[model samples]
Target: MAEGLFGVHAAALEVRSQRMGVLASNIANASTPNFKARDIDFTTALNAVESQPGGVGADLGGAVKYRVPTNPSMDGNTVELSTEQTAFAENAVQYQSTLAFLNGRIGQITRALKGE
Candidate 1:
């Protein structure tokens, strides 16, 4: 069940991954004058996701705290392109790695089924 996988290493990794995407988006728009840099509090989001009874990893990000514009931009653009890109790339790689692991696990299960 996806629920069982929720607390598993793979699931946790996936959750972090999605969070990374959000962070990247925030960073990318950091210089957009008015773009609000968005970041998810991972621990809190995960807990909220877990609290849902149906399953795990099913609930999307619970609540996003738009980083307060400590420095208001005159142009209204808040994207920090370079920073966001770097974060996005890193998150993408991690997400891919986790996906590969999960795929391998599924393959092993398939082999076992065939053997049986």
Candidate 2:
């Protein structure tokens, strides 16, 4: 019932949350030598989730890939602080948006159930 009510927003939130973690990790390892910055292909992951039977608990690991640096660092670290920070900020916004959508949906359901 909850799944039907929320549809893909729940899965989208999960993907956005995971993406935030990946981006944050990249930022944290920006100075670590040879640390390959990784990120998920959000659209692909969300599509994978929607295609699955339950559209939940979908494995997103396959969507994660190492980012190719625009300019290779001398130390071989692929993480660029500026890029990572931007991605992190963007993903955070997306996560918050998804959360808000879910909250609104829940409120609607609650009101309906209350006969209001």
Candidate 3:
């Protein structure tokens, strides 16, 4: 029932949340030598989640992958600060959007339950 009410937003929120963590990690490791930046394939992760029953307990391991840098650094770190920041900002926005959608849906459900 909850899944039906929330639809893809629930799973998307989870994916976005995870993605934020990955992006943040990349940003955090920007100066670390030999640190290979990683990211989640959002579409793949979302699909995997939606395919699961109730969109729960979906494994994101397959979706996480190393990000290839546009320019290889001498230090062997794949994390480009600008790229990581951009991705992080984008992911943050997406995460907030998904959260808003879920909140709105929940509010609607609550109102309906209360005969409002």
Writing each residue's lDDT as its tens digit, candidate 2 over 4-94 gives 8898898898788878888988988888998999999998899877777776677887899999999989999999898989889888888
Q: RMSD in Å for candidate 3, one decimal?
A: 1.3
Overall lDDT per candidate, in order of appearance: 0.64, 0.87, 0.89
Cα lDDT of model 1 by residue, 41-101, tens digit: 6677666666666434555655566655444567876545665576577767877777777
For candidate 3, list the clashing residue pairs, or say none.
Answer: none
TM-score of each: 0.65, 0.91, 0.92
Top candidate (TM-score): 3
* Prediction 2 global C-alpha lDDT: 0.87
- The deviation in Å at residue 45 for candidate 3 is 0.5
Ranking by TM-score: 3, 2, 1
Runs with alpha carbons beyond 4 Å of true place in candidate 3 = 53-57
lDDT (Cα, tens digit) per residue for candidate 3, span 1-116: 76778887899987888888889999999999999999999999999888888666678899999999999799999998999999999988888888988989889989999999
Order of candidate numbers by lDDT, starting with the best? 3, 2, 1
> What is the Cα root-mean-square deviation between model 1 and the actual structure?
3.6
Candidate 1: C-alpha lDDT = 0.64
Badly placed stretches (over 4 Å) of model 1 are: 5-10, 13-17, 20-33, 54-63, 68-72
